[model samples]
Target chain A: MSFFDRFFGKEKKKSAGVAKDRLMIAIAADRENSRIPNLDQMRAEIISVLEKYISIDEIEISKERKGDMDMLEIEVVVKSTG
Target chain B: MGIVFAVISGKGGVGKTTTSANLAIGTAMEGKKTVVVDFDIGQRNLDMILGLENRVVYDITHIMDGEANLSQALIKDKKNENLYFLAASQTKDKSVLERDKVKHLIDDLKENFDYIFLDSPAGIEGGFEHTIHYADNVIVVVNPEVSSIRDADRVIGLVDAKSHKAKAGETVGKFLLINRIDPELIEKNEMIATDDILDILSVTLLGKVPEDKRVIDASNTGKPVILHKESEAGKAYRRISKRLCGEDVPFEDVENAPSKGIMGKIKGLFK
Candidate 1:
């Protein structure tokens, strides 16, 4: 944080580091939706149906290709009601 | 088949045209028959960058429309016998390029040249897909900024999903070329590091060019920076061109890359 440290190039954190972290999160999110059209709409529909019976914590939709087949995998984490 | 390398970036002004010109010239200097095609259309700058603007008799559209033959449209570089150029039509927009026509042009060029460099325009729309459609390899140029990196990732994804190779259940070669790397900015925590970009993109590191002022000067003179032996960016481009030819050229540690010429040595003494 001091001028001495900056001059010696011993700063613990850099904006570039922060940028890398931010891009990782942003690009991953973008890639997830890029594969499927109307991904958010699809998620909303699924949530509306699921909310009728159960509480959902988080929903993750990922797509992967194996050979000539496309596999769309969904992971739904349920909210615990202890 | 000849290798088609597309110098593409979804964001504009990240040095795609500069890289295309330099790499094409560099490979030609290495004695490989090279042709650089301007696919920018309506905003063509490759001819100006190569200093061959006055000599363009016909362009890519002329060849495709049967108005001119390939030899008539193709302009051989006056300085380099192995290098040639194809100008993009200034009057036509990106929509003028169709898939089949682009394929025919590429196929014809493949029969003559060892390397074909496509200087792609900015944005992911219109003729952008055609540029990467038949690309054997793509050099994704990024400027170490958030918007540039984000747009480049989008283009990378498109290359995977849209390219002819990708459509045929094959993968097109993807390489990362991080441009305008300012070490002083990195030291001041202002710019992204080369390794950080490589880690984020998860692509092979083709080369990293240090930010240089001479690049603009080279552009102004219609000479690619690669021809300047004293320029750091030029040296980096030459190294990248060699790597494209399957040569094992080691990358320079751009953060600590030594400055060339006398003034650089004096500046180093202070550091």
Candidate 2:
């Protein structure tokens, strides 16, 4: 910490700390998502198959890591057709 | 058999070529026969860094296409007899580098040298894959910054999933070298601390090179910084080279090291 910052009481968080926090989150997401190939295409295929039966409002696809295995997760919110 | 090290950085201008040149020369000076190959293809610059541009008569592509023999393509270092270089073809298409050909070249290099350093191209496509595909080990060069660290993390994943050893159920050795460290910036909280970077990447620390003007000067003169024994960057590379050979070397405190810049001198007064 600089002398002025220490005396005046620093209010803002350090950029280095902010960078570290951002990197942690970004790297974790990259590790999980980057490993799975054609993720966007796979998500589209799943949405198409689901839309055939249900009125899909929203669909989210993500890859979650459990131990040495990767679990493909697909979450869909269905809409109520009147 | 020779150990192959791919000097890789996912981002450009992060000093992979510089590290490759220094490590090759440093190891060669240790009496180990070392060969540094430029895998950047059309953008080849390792020759310029090693001051071997004029000595290159045949390049790796020339050998791969059966136009020139390995013995002919390998340029013996003028300064260090133990050090050799294989320049990349300046005009060849990057896609022309076939997997089998690269494997053949690496296998040939393994037979002849004790150490083979492949200066990899930046990014994770085309030539980049070919560079790391045959590496027995990797030196991931990164600067203490957000983008560089993030890109290095992504490349680390590929190194594990793509390498020949990884496919063969063996693990490729991974090491991290953080370059261009400025103590003043770290003190001012403008730069990421070395330990923080190490924690994020989770790769074994090789050595931290101080941000030294001598590095740029050395490159401009086509001499690798490792030759300048007085320079801090040179000293850091020397220690890293020792570590590469399994020698126990203590890490110097880069953070507390007395700064030589004008800003550093100004900051020194406050301390």
- List DockQ for all candidates: 0.29, 0.33
Model 2 regions more than 4 Å off: A1-7, A37-82, B257-271
TM-scores, each model vs. reference:
0.80, 0.82
How many residue pairs clash in each candidate at the backbone level?
A: 0, 0
Expressed between 0 and 1, the share of native interface contacts present in candidate 2 is 0.70
> Model 2 misses residue B163 by how many Å?
0.6
Q: Report how far residue B132 has shifted in candidate 1, in Å.
A: 1.1
The lDDT for every candidate, in the order shown, is 0.88, 0.89
lDDT of candidate 1 over B109-204, digit per residue (tens): 999999999999898876678888999989999998999999999899888767888779887999999999987787656798887887888889
Best model number under DockQ = 2
For model 1, what is the error of residue B43's alpha carbon versus the real structure, in angstroms, after optimal superposition?
Answer: 0.4
Model 1 C-alpha lDDT per residue in residues A1-82, reported as the tens digit of each score: 5554567786687677788889999989778656798676899999999999999999988787666777888899999999
Clashing pairs in 1: none
What class would a CAPRI assessor give candidate 1's docking? acceptable
Model 2 has a clash total of 0
